[model samples]
Target: MADIVDTAVSAGSFTSLVAAVQAAGLVDTLKGPGPFTVFAPTDDAFAKLPAGTVEALFNDIPQLTKILTYHVVSGKVMAADVVKLTSAKTVEGSEVKIDASNGVKINDATVTAADVVADNGVIHVIDSVLLPA
Candidate 1:
Protein backbone atom coordinates (compact mmCIF):
# COMPACT_ATOMS: atom_id res chain seq x y z
CA MET A 1 0.00 0.00 0.00
CA ALA A 2 1.02 3.57 -0.56
CA ASP A 3 1.80 5.99 2.21
CA ILE A 4 -0.78 8.44 3.49
CA VAL A 5 -0.11 11.07 0.83
CA ASP A 6 0.14 8.66 -2.05
CA THR A 7 -2.82 6.62 -0.84
CA ALA A 8 -4.99 9.69 -0.72
CA VAL A 9 -3.90 10.74 -4.19
CA SER A 10 -4.67 7.31 -5.54
CA ALA A 11 -8.14 7.25 -3.96
CA GLY A 12 -9.23 10.06 -6.30
CA SER A 13 -12.08 10.95 -3.97
CA PHE A 14 -10.21 13.48 -1.88
CA THR A 15 -9.10 16.16 -4.32
CA SER A 16 -10.03 19.08 -2.11
CA LEU A 17 -8.45 17.39 0.89
CA VAL A 18 -5.29 16.60 -1.04
CA ALA A 19 -4.99 20.19 -2.19
CA ALA A 20 -5.48 21.47 1.31
CA VAL A 21 -2.87 19.07 2.66
CA GLN A 22 -0.39 20.27 0.06
CA ALA A 23 -1.17 23.89 0.81
CA ALA A 24 -0.66 23.30 4.51
CA GLY A 25 2.72 21.68 3.73
CA LEU A 26 1.52 18.61 5.60
CA VAL A 27 1.92 16.11 2.81
CA ASP A 28 5.40 15.16 3.94
CA THR A 29 4.34 14.95 7.55
CA LEU A 30 1.40 12.67 6.87
CA LYS A 31 3.59 10.58 4.61
CA GLY A 32 6.18 9.92 7.27
CA PRO A 33 6.72 6.84 9.44
CA GLY A 34 4.63 5.45 12.32
CA PRO A 35 0.86 5.20 12.25
CA PHE A 36 -1.85 7.80 11.81
CA THR A 37 -5.62 7.59 11.76
CA VAL A 38 -7.09 9.87 9.13
CA PHE A 39 -10.78 10.58 8.88
CA ALA A 40 -10.58 11.52 5.24
CA PRO A 41 -13.34 13.49 3.68
CA THR A 42 -14.31 12.79 0.13
CA ASP A 43 -14.45 15.47 -2.56
CA ASP A 44 -18.22 15.26 -2.39
CA ALA A 45 -18.02 16.27 1.23
CA PHE A 46 -16.05 19.40 0.33
CA ALA A 47 -18.58 20.24 -2.32
CA LYS A 48 -21.17 20.46 0.40
CA LEU A 49 -19.36 23.44 1.83
CA PRO A 50 -20.67 26.88 1.01
CA ALA A 51 -19.27 28.38 -2.12
CA GLY A 52 -15.82 29.98 -1.73
CA THR A 53 -15.14 28.15 1.54
CA VAL A 54 -12.54 25.87 0.04
CA GLU A 55 -11.01 28.71 -1.93
CA ALA A 56 -10.97 30.94 1.10
CA LEU A 57 -9.22 28.33 3.20
CA PHE A 58 -6.36 27.81 0.79
CA ASN A 59 -5.36 31.44 1.22
CA ASP A 60 -5.27 31.02 5.00
CA ILE A 61 -2.62 28.51 6.05
CA PRO A 62 -3.35 28.56 9.76
CA GLN A 63 -7.04 28.01 9.26
CA LEU A 64 -6.45 25.38 6.64
CA THR A 65 -4.02 23.50 8.84
CA LYS A 66 -6.39 23.63 11.74
CA ILE A 67 -9.26 22.26 9.71
CA LEU A 68 -7.11 19.56 8.14
CA THR A 69 -5.64 18.41 11.40
CA TYR A 70 -9.14 18.04 12.81
CA HIS A 71 -9.52 15.11 10.50
CA VAL A 72 -6.52 13.31 11.90
CA VAL A 73 -5.86 11.36 15.07
CA SER A 74 -2.31 10.70 16.26
CA GLY A 75 -2.23 6.90 16.22
CA LYS A 76 -3.42 4.25 13.84
CA VAL A 77 -6.96 3.87 15.11
CA MET A 78 -8.71 1.30 13.04
CA ALA A 79 -12.50 1.22 12.73
CA ALA A 80 -12.95 -1.37 15.42
CA ASP A 81 -10.81 0.57 17.86
CA VAL A 82 -12.55 3.81 17.07
CA VAL A 83 -16.01 2.37 17.61
CA LYS A 84 -15.19 1.64 21.20
CA LEU A 85 -14.61 5.27 22.04
CA THR A 86 -17.04 8.06 22.62
CA SER A 87 -14.51 10.58 21.43
CA ALA A 88 -10.96 10.88 20.20
CA LYS A 89 -8.49 13.70 20.36
CA THR A 90 -7.12 14.89 17.09
CA VAL A 91 -3.60 15.94 16.32
CA GLU A 92 -4.83 19.52 16.41
CA GLY A 93 -5.53 19.13 20.12
CA SER A 94 -9.27 19.09 19.72
CA GLU A 95 -11.68 16.33 20.61
CA VAL A 96 -13.82 14.78 17.88
CA LYS A 97 -17.01 13.17 19.01
CA ILE A 98 -17.30 9.60 17.89
CA ASP A 99 -20.74 8.05 17.71
CA ALA A 100 -20.58 4.42 16.83
CA SER A 101 -24.04 3.51 18.04
CA ASN A 102 -25.45 4.27 14.62
CA GLY A 103 -22.72 3.25 12.28
CA VAL A 104 -19.77 5.58 12.85
CA LYS A 105 -19.68 9.31 12.91
CA ILE A 106 -16.85 11.67 13.67
CA ASN A 107 -18.08 15.09 14.50
CA ASP A 108 -20.77 15.85 11.92
CA ALA A 109 -19.55 13.47 9.28
CA THR A 110 -20.55 9.87 8.84
CA VAL A 111 -18.00 7.19 8.09
CA THR A 112 -18.78 5.88 4.63
CA ALA A 113 -15.75 3.65 4.32
CA ALA A 114 -13.36 2.39 6.90
CA ASP A 115 -10.10 0.61 7.44
CA VAL A 116 -8.42 1.57 4.21
CA VAL A 117 -4.84 0.46 4.56
CA ALA A 118 -1.95 2.76 3.86
CA ASP A 119 1.71 2.31 4.35
CA ASN A 120 1.88 4.82 7.17
CA GLY A 121 -1.60 4.40 8.60
CA VAL A 122 -5.30 3.85 7.91
CA ILE A 123 -7.98 5.93 6.25
CA HIS A 124 -11.62 6.19 7.15
CA VAL A 125 -13.59 7.94 4.47
CA ILE A 126 -16.11 10.44 5.78
CA ASP A 127 -19.05 11.98 4.00
CA SER A 128 -18.45 15.43 5.40
CA VAL A 129 -15.40 17.52 6.16
CA LEU A 130 -14.89 18.03 9.87
CA LEU A 131 -14.38 21.55 11.15
CA PRO A 132 -12.86 22.56 14.43
CA ALA A 133 -15.21 24.02 16.96
Candidate 2:
Protein backbone atom coordinates (compact mmCIF):
# COMPACT_ATOMS: atom_id res chain seq x y z
CA MET A 1 0.00 0.00 0.00
CA ALA A 2 1.04 3.63 -0.49
CA ASP A 3 1.76 6.04 2.33
CA ILE A 4 -0.74 8.52 3.76
CA VAL A 5 0.22 11.27 1.30
CA ASP A 6 -0.03 8.99 -1.71
CA THR A 7 -3.21 7.47 -0.41
CA ALA A 8 -4.92 10.83 -0.12
CA VAL A 9 -3.72 11.96 -3.51
CA SER A 10 -5.09 8.78 -5.09
CA ALA A 11 -8.45 9.25 -3.35
CA GLY A 12 -9.19 12.20 -5.72
CA SER A 13 -11.68 13.90 -3.39
CA PHE A 14 -8.97 15.44 -1.27
CA THR A 15 -7.54 17.88 -3.75
CA SER A 16 -7.82 20.92 -1.52
CA LEU A 17 -6.57 18.98 1.46
CA VAL A 18 -3.61 17.58 -0.43
CA ALA A 19 -2.69 21.02 -1.71
CA ALA A 20 -2.93 22.48 1.75
CA VAL A 21 -0.70 19.73 3.09
CA GLN A 22 1.85 20.51 0.42
CA ALA A 23 1.69 24.24 1.03
CA ALA A 24 2.20 23.66 4.70
CA GLY A 25 5.43 21.81 3.84
CA LEU A 26 4.14 18.74 5.63
CA VAL A 27 4.29 16.41 2.68
CA ASP A 28 7.48 14.82 3.94
CA THR A 29 6.11 14.47 7.43
CA LEU A 30 2.90 12.81 6.30
CA LYS A 31 4.91 10.66 3.95
CA GLY A 32 7.23 9.58 6.74
CA PRO A 33 7.10 6.23 8.48
CA GLY A 34 4.61 7.14 11.14
CA PRO A 35 1.37 5.43 11.97
CA PHE A 36 -0.63 8.65 11.87
CA THR A 37 -4.39 8.78 12.04
CA VAL A 38 -5.61 11.58 9.83
CA PHE A 39 -9.13 12.96 9.85
CA ALA A 40 -9.07 13.97 6.21
CA PRO A 41 -11.54 16.47 4.83
CA THR A 42 -12.75 16.63 1.27
CA ASP A 43 -12.68 19.61 -1.10
CA ASP A 44 -16.38 20.11 -0.54
CA ALA A 45 -15.84 20.32 3.16
CA PHE A 46 -13.29 23.11 2.63
CA ALA A 47 -15.84 24.96 0.53
CA LYS A 48 -18.03 25.08 3.62
CA LEU A 49 -15.67 27.72 4.97
CA PRO A 50 -16.37 31.35 4.27
CA ALA A 51 -14.91 32.91 1.19
CA GLY A 52 -11.23 33.93 1.46
CA THR A 53 -10.63 31.66 4.45
CA VAL A 54 -8.66 29.11 2.47
CA GLU A 55 -6.71 31.80 0.68
CA ALA A 56 -5.87 33.52 3.91
CA LEU A 57 -4.67 30.26 5.41
CA PHE A 58 -2.49 29.49 2.44
CA ASN A 59 -0.69 32.77 2.94
CA ASP A 60 -0.09 31.93 6.57
CA ILE A 61 2.12 28.88 6.62
CA PRO A 62 2.25 28.49 10.40
CA GLN A 63 -1.50 28.67 10.75
CA LEU A 64 -1.99 26.34 7.81
CA THR A 65 0.39 23.82 9.31
CA LYS A 66 -1.34 24.02 12.66
CA ILE A 67 -4.75 23.48 11.15
CA LEU A 68 -3.49 20.63 9.02
CA THR A 69 -1.71 18.91 11.86
CA TYR A 70 -4.77 19.31 14.02
CA HIS A 71 -6.48 16.79 11.78
CA VAL A 72 -3.93 14.17 12.71
CA VAL A 73 -3.24 12.06 15.75
CA SER A 74 0.17 10.62 16.58
CA GLY A 75 -0.63 6.96 16.13
CA LYS A 76 -2.80 4.80 13.93
CA VAL A 77 -6.15 4.70 15.67
CA MET A 78 -8.72 2.68 13.76
CA ALA A 79 -12.45 3.37 13.61
CA ALA A 80 -13.25 0.68 16.17
CA ASP A 81 -10.79 2.16 18.65
CA VAL A 82 -11.82 5.68 17.85
CA VAL A 83 -15.43 4.88 18.70
CA LYS A 84 -14.38 3.95 22.20
CA LEU A 85 -12.65 7.21 22.93
CA THR A 86 -14.03 10.50 24.17
CA SER A 87 -11.10 12.47 22.82
CA ALA A 88 -7.69 12.15 21.25
CA LYS A 89 -4.64 14.39 21.36
CA THR A 90 -3.61 15.80 18.04
CA VAL A 91 -0.14 16.13 16.63
CA GLU A 92 -0.59 19.88 16.83
CA GLY A 93 -0.62 19.59 20.62
CA SER A 94 -4.34 20.00 21.08
CA GLU A 95 -7.07 17.55 21.90
CA VAL A 96 -9.98 16.85 19.60
CA LYS A 97 -13.28 15.61 20.98
CA ILE A 98 -14.56 12.33 19.66
CA ASP A 99 -18.22 11.41 19.83
CA ALA A 100 -19.18 7.96 18.72
CA SER A 101 -22.59 8.01 20.35
CA ASN A 102 -23.96 8.48 16.91
CA GLY A 103 -21.67 7.68 13.99
CA VAL A 104 -18.13 8.94 14.55
CA LYS A 105 -17.33 12.56 15.04
CA ILE A 106 -14.00 14.28 15.35
CA ASN A 107 -14.79 17.65 16.83
CA ASP A 108 -17.45 19.16 14.56
CA ALA A 109 -16.69 16.90 11.60
CA THR A 110 -18.48 13.64 10.92
CA VAL A 111 -16.56 10.61 9.78
CA THR A 112 -17.94 9.89 6.33
CA ALA A 113 -15.52 7.05 5.63
CA ALA A 114 -13.29 5.12 7.95
CA ASP A 115 -10.26 2.89 8.15
CA VAL A 116 -8.56 3.83 4.89
CA VAL A 117 -5.37 1.98 5.55
CA ALA A 118 -2.00 3.22 4.26
CA ASP A 119 1.57 2.09 4.57
CA ASN A 120 2.26 4.75 7.17
CA GLY A 121 -1.12 4.93 8.84
CA VAL A 122 -4.88 5.31 8.43
CA ILE A 123 -7.30 7.84 7.06
CA HIS A 124 -10.80 8.62 8.26
CA VAL A 125 -12.74 10.80 5.87
CA ILE A 126 -14.35 13.71 7.70
CA ASP A 127 -17.11 15.94 6.39
CA SER A 128 -15.43 19.10 7.74
CA VAL A 129 -11.96 20.38 8.34
CA LEU A 130 -10.76 20.40 11.92
CA LEU A 131 -9.38 23.55 13.52
CA PRO A 132 -7.25 23.94 16.57
CA ALA A 133 -8.51 25.57 19.75
Per model, state how many residue pairs clash.
Answer: 0, 0
Judging by lDDT against the true structure, name the best candidate.
2
lDDT tens digits, residue span 6-118, model 2: 99999999999999999999999999999899999999999999999999999999999999999999999999999999999999998999999999989899999999999
TM-score of each: 0.98, 0.99
Clash pairs for candidate 2: none
For model 1, how does the per-residue alpha-carbon lDDT over 42-98 read when each residue is reduced to its tens digit? 999999999999999999999999999989998899998999999999999989999
Question: What Cα-based lDDT does every candidate model obtain?
Answer: 0.93, 0.95
* Superposition-based RMSD of candidate 1 using all C-alpha atoms, in angstroms: 0.6
- Which consecutive 10 residues in model 2 have the weakest lDDT in total? 124-133
Q: What is residue 3's positional error in candidate 1, in angstroms?
A: 0.3
Query: In angstroms, how far off is 47's CA in candidate 1?
Result: 0.3
